[model samples]
Target: MGLRKKVIWITGASSGIGEALAYEFNKKGAHLILSARRTGELERVKENCSNHEESVKILPLDLAEADQMEAKAVEALAMYGHVDMLINNGGVSQRSYAVDTEMSTVRKVMEVNFFGTVGLTKALLPEMIKQKSGHIVVISSVMGKFGTKFRSTYAASKHALHGYFDSLRQELYEHNVNVSLVCPGYVKTDVTINALTGSGEKFNKMGKGQKNAMPPEEFAKKLIPKLAAGKDEIYLGGAELMGVYLKRFVPGLFSKLLKRVRVT
Candidate 1:
């Protein structure tokens, strides 16, 4: 996973962490296939990159639409021959009261964040197995380790990612396919503002935790090497990495701490 000439495909590359990652990885000399719904923004990102402009390829599509991912992946493979790593970062977050949240909103978040990720992973896995080398990096959240108030669906989706990818790592070990789960806590991104509300509308703002979040570039700089080192799962956040170990070693106390936490 130490890039070099690795053919890496990153979904959700339009902005935020993904955009910063694209530039950083491009500088590292990885051939990139960038994916998102916004072709214009992809072009803009490509324009903004300081080097390796030709290394970036754009594949625009909605992650929620699982039907299209397999085909699009084929198109990517046709262009790049093979993908050494697939960073499944395309997802949405839902932050709303569980009781008041519409079923549609919950399902939409799962469809994009969990199930669609599954679809793309499954699609690319065969080739990975055949090549006997590939890495699947999932952009999960700190909520994956510990759930919180008003973010039920998003937490569940991220948690589901951990369940699936961790299992995949164990199952695919002999085949040389590695799985890395990235849990970022309150990264400075538009994620909170675009998070879905209970009524299936935009949340239209940021939470207090988000206001003091880590910069995406700094987060990526800290994270990429761990991934390159083949860490199976890693967490990123200012004060939130404590939650991951706390939940594992002291569940009851972690629960009590979470109860008093003012995440919003």
Candidate 2:
């Protein structure tokens, strides 16, 4: 029942939380399939794992390519004959106002963050159902629970994830497949640097909150235990975590306070 020898596929494994998870899981003797659009970086991450030669493999993938995910899912399953868990961590972030954001940028974000994730999950869902055992972990954001400035579209995609996965949890209950939604507040990752602006250009700068965010390694360490405990949904991060509660308990007060938050 522990992570030992469990085959876990982690997308966005080239860096940030995914990379950190790879290392942590590797130490626990889990077999890993690391994935991302950056094959070279994935290889580097593989090399750093505990038993790189036999315990880890890399699969290059672009979550934006929703059309190809079903095929990729087949390929992923073939890597180890079965996958005990799939971590849907590949996604893009946003850094622009709704009015200034172009339709194309909005669509691109949704495509990669929402549709792409769903496509890949659907591709793997049948197998999980057939086996009657599997775990689906989604790396959503605090924005999923509440709206914030400069993250309208990004928030929308994450919100969509919650709705889709919450329903999925109920549907898969009888089948024994588990869905865990991880809502991260702020982590010190390159997400901000690569966030898309209204013009569809990279933001290229880290925000104050991001710079002061939790380290991915620490975040991963704290997360795995909760995940292993079979939590359905978990909120992880720093001071920003209060937003999740305030949004639920004090909707009006939270809305007024959200307006003053400097999300960038």
Candidate 3:
């Protein structure tokens, strides 16, 4: 169960939860492959790691580019010959109301959040199955569990991930390739500021709730232990996590609460 010397590839690793997880995993002696669209930022994260020279490698990638995933996966596996884990953490966020959002924006979000993640997973899956060991972890949002205002397509994309990954997990059970979904509530990150608006422009403003959400480092600290324990589904955040349960058990009440809660 220990991650020591394990080859772990993490996407969206330039900042936020991905970066934090990179540092934590590096601390645990894991060989890290840090990936993101920005090679410079990935280098920055690498330099900040405990043993960057020997333990960390940077791979630049854009999750929205589905066609490139297969090659990327091949390159990732080449980093340390075989990967023990792949964390599907790269994605974009939406801040537009459903009525005002453009179709292109919806497609863009889905490309990065849903199809892109799925493509990469499929590309690497056969290798994992052949190795008879691997972990696929996704950083899905709490939105995957329920819906609210201003996140129609974002919620839809995450919901789709749940359905697809759930089915994939069942199929991979016999193959011994573990699939886990990490549902995170609001966390202190640039997700909101970088969120696409109705016109497909960046929101560029920090959200009220996001400003006070759990720190990425703290979230990573709590998540790594659960992952090491081989948990299938892990939820991390503050009180916002309650919304998931509330939506599941008391649909009527959760619907009412959503009307009043400040999501953005």
Candidate 4:
């Protein structure tokens, strides 16, 4: 279906890729329900969209507050009728060494990336199933495909998403609800700085490598159409996405290569 009439609900819309997708979809004529913890940033993003004159409702939220999510969905749905798609885009990254990482840090990341996605999707599945058509787009990462240096917990969180969403797709296929996962390498975002560490505080700044990553707006411009056409899984990045396939076929060499990576 065309994006023009779709009522899309996106989490983490305050900044980064989510904000970029907001504008992209708005330009394509989709109704938007933007959710994030920062209302001010959401307002700025809402205003930036080319079709600001259309319905653009902002819902402030912390995805990690998993218990209240269903109610949040209720409130969000009330804004626009039925949600045509729910983008599970809110998540935190882990930046400390796993050995030194506290249980709390790992749990927090899972809470947002894994459990939060689960809760929200679960709450909405029945409605979508009843409607017989819906799309759940998950924003996972290349880290989801393989573990890397300095990102053990982050890797685990993304890995968990692949497991969960893949199974959901299989289970729901007969019902006509589509679940697609997007695996992106790195886009220019404040993710590293906002990432959490062992003590449950921010990593405090962006990584050196992330400073030169692709811009979010450019990434979305390419990603939206593929999603609209029902592509099952998508991987976007320069050469980094190649590593996913390399590891699958020539795993021994891939393992050796990963040793030399100084991931920031």
Candidate 5:
């Protein structure tokens, strides 16, 4: 029941949290379908995993290309005959102010973070419903629960994910398909450096907060067990996590505090 032999498909598996999750899942004896836009990086991740030659398979995917996800989902299903879990982890972040950011940049963020993730889930949903077994895990963020400066579109995308998956969990309740949202705080990843800017360019510089964040490997180690236990939602890392609750319980104070925070 705890990931042994489970066919788990992970997107964004080329690096960071997704890469760490791949190793953790591999160690837990789960067969993995590793995916990302970079085939070479996926292969590198696969090689670093346990029993890669047999249990790991690389599936290069670009989440922004929403049109291709259906076919990719089919390919994923064919690999292991059935996917026990689908980890929707591919996404991009923003580091530009709302007014300065181009509409194209906003749409691009939505395409990769929200629409694309939902599109793939929709593609695989029927099969999961038919089989009446599967888990849809999303790597959302603490930003999903609250707004922040220079991340208007990024926060919007994650907020959309929360709404979509929350509804999906309710609808799929009888279908035996579990939906889990993982809201990680500040995890050590290339998120800030790869974040999109006003002109749709990468920020290319890491934030100081990110440098002090929890290690992706350590975060994955704590996360996988809770996920396997079927947790509906899990939060990890720093004091920013407190904002998730404060936003709910003390909106006024949370709003004031959010404005003063150095979110970058």
Candidate 6:
């Protein structure tokens, strides 16, 4: 569908893929609701948009606070009277082994990555169904398709999104609502630097894969058309995307390869 004048609400708009998407969508003449925990960073992103004064609205949100999602959804619907699309892009990453990770840390990751996303979607779903039109886009990861070292909870959270949204897609299909699950391989973003450790502290270091991953802007540029095409499942990245296939068709070989790959 054409994006001109479409009201798109995107979480995690302060940085990374979400930020790039805001700018790209703005370029397509789409109205934007930018959200994240950092109000200042949200404002920075808004100001950087093409028509920030008229087309962009800042809505500071913290996904970890899932309880507030309904209220936030009401506030968002009030902004444009209706939302054409909701991008579930706000999430935290884990950089800890499952055995080393504390239960609290696991809960924190699951809360932010899975529960929070689902809560927000559930809040807005009624409105979309009422309108009989909407697009739900999720920015999942390659880890969603397969597990690796140091990302047990992170991978689980992503896997949960696939299950939840895949089912949601079937239910929403007859209602004219579209659901897109976007599985991104490594992208050059601060996700790694801000990833949670076993103790819940920030990883604070960019991994080799992350440093050399696709640029967020480039990734966004390639993603917009696929989104417009209403693709049910979208995958973007480098060779890492191949793992999704390997795990699907040749689990034995994929499992052997996983042991040797440096996942961080």
Model 3 TM-score (2 dp) = 0.98
In model 4, the worst 10-residue window by lDDT is 46-55
> In model 2, which range of ten residues has the least summed lDDT?
255-264
TM per prediction: 0.96, 0.98, 0.98, 0.97, 0.98, 0.99
Give, for candidate 1, the lowest lDDT window spanning 10 residues.
46-55
List the global CA lDDT of all models: 0.88, 0.93, 0.93, 0.89, 0.93, 0.95
Model 3 segments more than 4 A misplaced: none
Give the per-residue lDDT of model 5 (tens digit) for 7-55: 9999999999999999999998999999999999998998898788989
**Model 6 residue 105 distance off true place after TM-score fit, in angstroms:** 0.5
lDDT of 3 at 108: 97
Question: What's the CA error at residue 255 for candidate 2, in Å?
Answer: 1.0
Query: Candidate 1 on 1-264: residue-level lDDT in tens?
Result: 467778889899999899989888888888899899999999888777655456878889798999887898899898779999999988888878899999999999999999899999998999999999999999998889888889999999988998888889998999999999988887989898888999889988887887888988998788889998999878788777888889999999999998997766
List ranges where model 2 is wrong by over 4 Å: none
The number of the candidate with the highest lDDT is: 6
lDDT of 2 at 213: 87
lDDT of 2: 0.93
Candidates 2 and 6, the one with greater lDDT: 6
| Candidate 4: segments with Cα more than 4 A from true spot | 51-53
Clashes of each: 0, 0, 0, 1, 0, 0
Pairs of residues clashing in candidate 6: none
RMSD of each: 1.3, 0.8, 0.9, 1.2, 0.9, 0.7
The residue-by-residue lDDT of candidate 4 on 180-240, one tens digit each, is 8999987999999999888889998888767888899999998997898888898887788
Runs in model 5 with CA error above 4 Å? none
